[model samples]
Target: MVSGGINEILRAVEFILSKLLSELQSEDENDVEPKTKVRLIVPNGSCGGIICKGCATIRSFIEKSQAGIKISPQDNNYYGLNDRLVTLTGTLDDNKCFNT
Candidate 1:
């Protein structure tokens, strides 16, 4: 009975280690890419309400968005609205804006 219990514990430890190794491998693979670029056309105006305020300028909005930050512009404010009319072409990485 003691030996059997020890075997079971060892199996559990091995299973946990295998899972951790798999996750580590996946994380390494994901890290290989390092970053990706995506362009979005934001509306020229305040997002109002929540999630997107004070993001009046394209640069500011992009900076805030990349930082995983949120701002609240006034209701019906025209901050990010202009970008909608004119398309913005740029590159972004996992960190922030990247030069194309």
Candidate 2:
């Protein structure tokens, strides 16, 4: 037989546990985000072809891109240049926040 105070405490604990479990479950369902690949579409002018002539300009554009891109600090390699395709990898959102 439980005393009144102990019974009240147990009930409160059970209620808190139930609430926590529900919250966890809900978060699990809604917290998943899809990560995909994003590529740069170099326009015509000096930024076309496999070996782009405007490599510096393209690099500068990506460095200053409004899209939130997660780039490696050690990654200073030029992409879309010398017939090479460089890809940036990370999870991005509509706001362009890239995860490093």
Candidate 3:
């Protein structure tokens, strides 16, 4: 009789755990954001790109903002002028924040 009671309790605990696990998984799936918005930061007439890759502020923003940033490949022409393509995983507001 005691063994039967222990087995019932164990099964109940397992059922409760499975329900909690599914709920937690659903919440995690909703928490992640997809990168859909794209913006191109054009270069200036002079040296450095609009978002200078070498700048400390830009690097810090990229690391924390969860946005994807790509600069034009360096070459003869792009070296003097660069274009920064920013892919925002969060929202359009992120670009304004980064620009400031």
Best by TM-score: 3
**True-structure RMSD, every candidate:** 17.3, 21.9, 21.4
Off by over 4 Å in 1: 1-4, 30-100
**Model 2: per-residue Cα lDDT over 1-100, one tens digit each:** 2336866966764465456445555666564443334443323332343224655544554555433333222223666433222344433333232221
- Where is the poorest 10-residue window by lDDT in model 2? 91-100
Report the alpha-carbon TM-score of model 2 versus the true structure: 0.26
In candidate 3, how many Å is residue 42 off? Answer: 0.4
- Judging by lDDT against the true structure, name the best candidate: 3
Write model 3 residue lDDT over 4-85, tens digit each, in one string: 5866866664455456445655666664432244444544432253355567655756677655555544455545544444
Clashing pairs in 3: none
**Which of candidates 2 and 3 reaches a greater lDDT?**
3
TM-score of each: 0.26, 0.26, 0.36
RMSD of 3: 21.4
Superposition error at 81 for model 1 (Å): 63
| Superior by TM-score: candidate 2 or candidate 3 | 3
